[model samples]
Every structure is written in C-alpha cells, then in structure tokens.
Target chain A: MREIQVEYFAALREHAGCGRERLRTAARTPRELFAELSRRHGFPELGPLKVAVNDEFGDWEAPLADGDSVVFIPPVAGG
Target chain B: MKPFAFSAEPLQPASLRRSLADPRCGAFVSFEGWVRNHNDGREVRALEYEAYEQLGLKEGARIVQEAIERFGVDHAACVHRVGALALGDLAVWVGVSSAHRDAAFAACRYIIDEVKHRVPIWKKEHYADGDSGWVNCERCASHAQPPPARQAGR
Candidate 1:
C-alpha cells in the first residue's frame, strides 16, 4: 500500500467536496487511484483528463510512491 | 520578473507594458482577455478562476519561453487572474516586444493561445439564472463551435 496526497481543482473539487486529502491506497498508478477515488467520492465522468504527480504533469500509468502528491487536471479553459 | 505568473489582485496592463520597454525592440504587442458577460447563451454574472499553481506556473513559464524561442522575441510576459472576477475585468494579459511588428504580433498570439490550451487553469462561470458550470468540463459540448469567418466588407 502507498500513501498519497491528492488535490482537486475546479469541477473535481466541487464534486469531490474537498480540495485536498491524503490516504492510503493499494492502487499503484494515477489511473487506478482515480478510479478508486471516483468510487468513493462519486466524481463525475470528466471525459479527457491529465494527471500530475509531485507537481509535474505525469502520465496516467506512472508509478506512485508513498507521500507523493497528485492532481487530476480536467480540460482547461483560460485565455 | 518572471515571464508568467498568476495574480489574485487585479491586473495592471500599463505597468506590464512598461516592463517590456527596450531600446533594441521597436514594437510592442499585447492581448487582454476580459471577463465577458455571456457565454453559450447564458448570461454570465461573474467568474471564479482556479489553478493548480505548481503546474500552472511551470507550464506557463515554459510557454513564455517557447514564445521567445519560437518567434525570436526579445521579451514577453503573461499574467492570469485567480479567484472571483466580475464582468469586464481583465482576466489575462500578455505582452511581447520585438525588433519588428511581425514577431511581436505572432509571439503575443502564441502565448495567449498556448496559455489557454496548456495551462492548468479553470474557469467556473456563474450565470445570471443562478446557475454555474466549469467552462470546458461541464458544458464543452455546447460551447464548441466552428472557426469564425470574416464578415463581409471589413
């Protein structure tokens, strides 16, 4: 099991009902971790997204380590 | 000053413009993204912008650097606002300076476009009807539209 810190933004934050959380999980990748959290939080179907590990853009399949921070980036809209 | 940054307070474009002053550069171009009052047929009352600052700043700085390298511009800077913003507020500003007009114009455009598509910033618009939605995530299907064509007789 790995302990990870997950942060939410925009719609994910609204749906997840919190901005940040830390928990222990058996999931090893961001994709798997997101799936577990989605079930727990009822996160909406966000369509296409990106994941960040340790404050850098990360691949969905990247391995997660204990005490790592992750953020799922929804489709961005800025001008 | 850094090439890209986020501001919680209102943006000051004039000062940003002055920052790009250079004796070698003869042209300056800028773009300002304002908080408009409507979107996808909804009357927007206000907007709240949120960003993953760590990634946003990193990506944003890379974009500015890319603009400088790609277009050969002398200097460039961009600032995006966070938190609540009312209608007509300056949401973002980009300034570029170059030895000529062409590079300045192209770099300015590149910075703004890439910033919109690449930066990890999100906008949640509050509508006049007491409804709100994230700009691209919640209502993207309806918001997508064809490229604008030039009007007759400009």
Candidate 2:
C-alpha cells in the first residue's frame, strides 16, 4: 500500500476540520486517491477540483508515489 | 514562474514590485484587492481564506500560463491571504509583467479574473453583527447560465 499525503483548504478544510492527512491507498492516480479518500470520509465535493503534485499543476490521472504531497483545492474565493 | 506568495497579512506593493523586478521585465501591472467593509449590504467585519496548498499553487500557476498563452506576458504573480483578517486587511493581489504594457495590463486583469472564477479558494465573511457566511467564487457557481437571444423570430 502506497501512502498518500493529503492537504485540504477553505471550505473543505472547514468541513473536514483539519489541514493535512496521511493515509495508505491502493489507488493509482490522484483522482483515484481522492475518490478513495472521499469514499472513506464522505466528501462528495472532492470531484471537479484541480490537483497539484510536488508544487506543480497536475492532472487527476497523475500517478502517485510512496511519498507525494497531494493537495485538493476546490474553487476558492480570492481577489 | 515563481508563485506570488499568498499570506494572511497585509500585502505590500513594494514587496510585490520587488518580486517582479526582473531586468527582462519591461512593463508591470498590478491589481489590489482591498477589504471591503460591506458585502451585499451588510457590514463586514473580516474575512477568512483557506486552500489546499498543492492545488492552489498549481491553479495559480496555470492561470499565469493561460494568460501568457492567451495574451502574451513575460511573467505573472498572484497572491492571496488567508486566515482571520481584519476590516482593512489585504485579501488578494495579482501582478503581471511583460515586454509590452498592453499585454501586461490585459494579462494581469485576465489572471485575476480567472483566479477568482476558477481557483478552489473559499472565503468566510465575518459581519459586524457577529454573523458570518462563506463566500464562494461566484463565477464558479454551477447555476445561472447566460440567456440565449432570439434569432429573428419570424
């Protein structure tokens, strides 16, 4: 099982009431990883969100490694 | 392609300018987001911002790239503050640079607009009356599409 690092922000952070998490996954890509987390955590809004890997913009299909920093940023309100 | 560091404190024009101080940069344009005391008619006390780090930065960079692709620019930086903010705190800021003023100005505007409409950042508005509500990106709202025009009904 590969370990996935997760970070949440804004409303998702508020809803989850946490900032970061590390979990084990049998998932292959970012989308799959998120889907698994959402399934286990009941966060339906995880979809339609853009993701990033190692500080660069990436697609949901981006493959995961043993220690990758994955962030799920929803549509945020900014200036 | 450096990201304009977003924070929860007041934003400084000098610092932003410093960040864009590249010798190759010929033109610079910036957009300042101030703390509006009112929202939809209520007195706003403060606002809180939060985001997913990797995703937010990636989206911000993508917005910059899109602007460069669409409008042509030398460099772009977009920063947004989060956490509990006061009445007059800086909320968001964007800076764009290019070899020409026209591209810089337009790209800066486009970057800000796209970030507001596209990025996954959320704001919680704290009102003066001790009430608060979350403010989502209006442009991203799934409802209310543009109305179709009549095609010379005959």
Q: Over the true interface residues, superposed, what is the Cα RMSD of model 2? A: 10.9
Give the per-residue lDDT digits (tens) of candidate 1, residues A1-79: 9999999999889878999999999999887788898778777655577788898887776678999999988889997
lDDT of 1 at B153: 9
* Candidate 1 residue runs with Cα over 4 Å from true position: B139-154
Best by lDDT: 1
lDDT of each: 0.87, 0.71
Clashing pairs in 2: A9-B51, A10-B50, A74-B120, A75-B120, A75-B121, A76-B119, A76-B120, A76-B121, A76-B122, A77-B121
lDDT of 1 by residue, B6-84 (tens): 9999999989999999999999999999999999988999999998999899999999999999999999999999999
Tens-digit lDDT track of model 2 for A30-78 = 7677667665655533224566676555666656899988776564567
lDDT of 2 by residue, B46-74 (tens): 88776554456767777888888888787
Interface RMSD of each: 11.2, 10.9
